[model samples]
Target: MAKASVNSPSGPASVETLTTRGRKTRDALLDAARTVFEDVGFPEARVELITAAAQVSYGTFYRYFESKEDVFRVLSDQLFEDIHHRGPSDSTLSPAQRLIAANRTYYQAYRRNARLMAIVEQVATFNDDFRRLRHDHRHQLIDRQARAIARWQQEGLVRQSLDPEMAARAMSAMVDHTLYLWLVQGDEANEALLLDTLDQMCLGALGLDQD
Candidate 1:
């Protein structure tokens, strides 16, 4: 099994050193923190409330997390990881089809986690640490996509004239900003139609329409 861990202000130095029981307590706090953050938003959230929600004592909470923000940061890290997640490759699909599939996956994930994402956006406004974290994560996603675009160029799918790095950054930003408007800004859209339009835009950029 593959596991992913993140390093952040809220993350532990290492979780692998913890006992199984300690890990369970840490996970429970994180799960409870997610509910509380969504219910009350990050700024208004309290460690007491989280401990109450988790059915754990204050001492138990402190044993795992230093403060409410600590738990909240961990929760945000997990959600961000989920947002950046990639599904297994489908070799049968064309490059265009693969791009469509990846976009759909991202859109649906954003929709599911929209409220939390909105809160993250709000918090990042005044929180330099969080803003930096979000920027780093965004670039990481762009870099991943850029590598894919470079491969398509090598395979003679995308135009060799296009710079994969710049194209990937632009394309990822297009999707991110579009979805942020639709999801966080409460813009109404038909999902199927929106995805179709996005597919057309992406395919056109890749010159898949010419092929």
Candidate 2:
């Protein structure tokens, strides 16, 4: 029902056009669902509320998602996809450089989806469905980063003693906690504070000397 525009070309124009349209529809529905969920929470965010907000009918909603949990799963997966490309693609930048890029993307995504993050955090605490859904996505992201951290350690970009799994978990915790605090409390999620905090934690965990 709504159109989303793609300005910069990343691939063939025709394919990009199709992708832009599909992405827009999904994003619109997700955004609307998040808003309804934030206002009414997981238990009360009915399909009607979401469909109404998205200006779509119940049939349209089902065409895109089977259930509310399905949408929530999509939301978490989309968040991870937004953060990392999850491929062994080449990057001209070093590992640390790429990590910084990923961190920035994560924070920006958190800011943009603050309401949804809040809803997910609350639902995750007591709801097994939400918890399992969120946990699965998080585990995948952590594992991927762990592999990258292992590579960085082998290259001496990180300290030899830093356990990649532990480092990945710590990084995930930091991002989650930071976002939760900002979103739940309406506090300013300062970029500098986030960067400084993450940098310090990473440096300490990796046993790197203070720069």
- Tens-place lDDT per residue, model 2, 1-211, is 1112222333112324446666677668888987787788777878789989998766666655656777776776666566544435447865655666676667677777677677777878987877887788789889988998898778777877778999899878987786677666766867688677876676567654543
Using lDDT as the measure, the top candidate is: 1
Model 1 misplacement above 4 A: 1-14
What value does the lDDT take at residue 66 in candidate 1?
A: 62
Q: Quantify all predictions' global Cα lDDT against the true fold.
A: 0.80, 0.70
Q: Residues 114-163, candidate 1: write the lDDT tens digits.
A: 88898888888988878887888888898998899899888888888888
TM-score of 2: 0.72
TM-score list, all predictions: 0.86, 0.72
- Stretch of 10 with least lDDT, candidate 2: 1-10
The residue ranges of model 2 lying beyond 4 angstroms of the native Cα positions read: 1-31, 58-60, 85-90, 188-190, 208-211
Question: Candidate 2 clashing pairs?
Answer: none
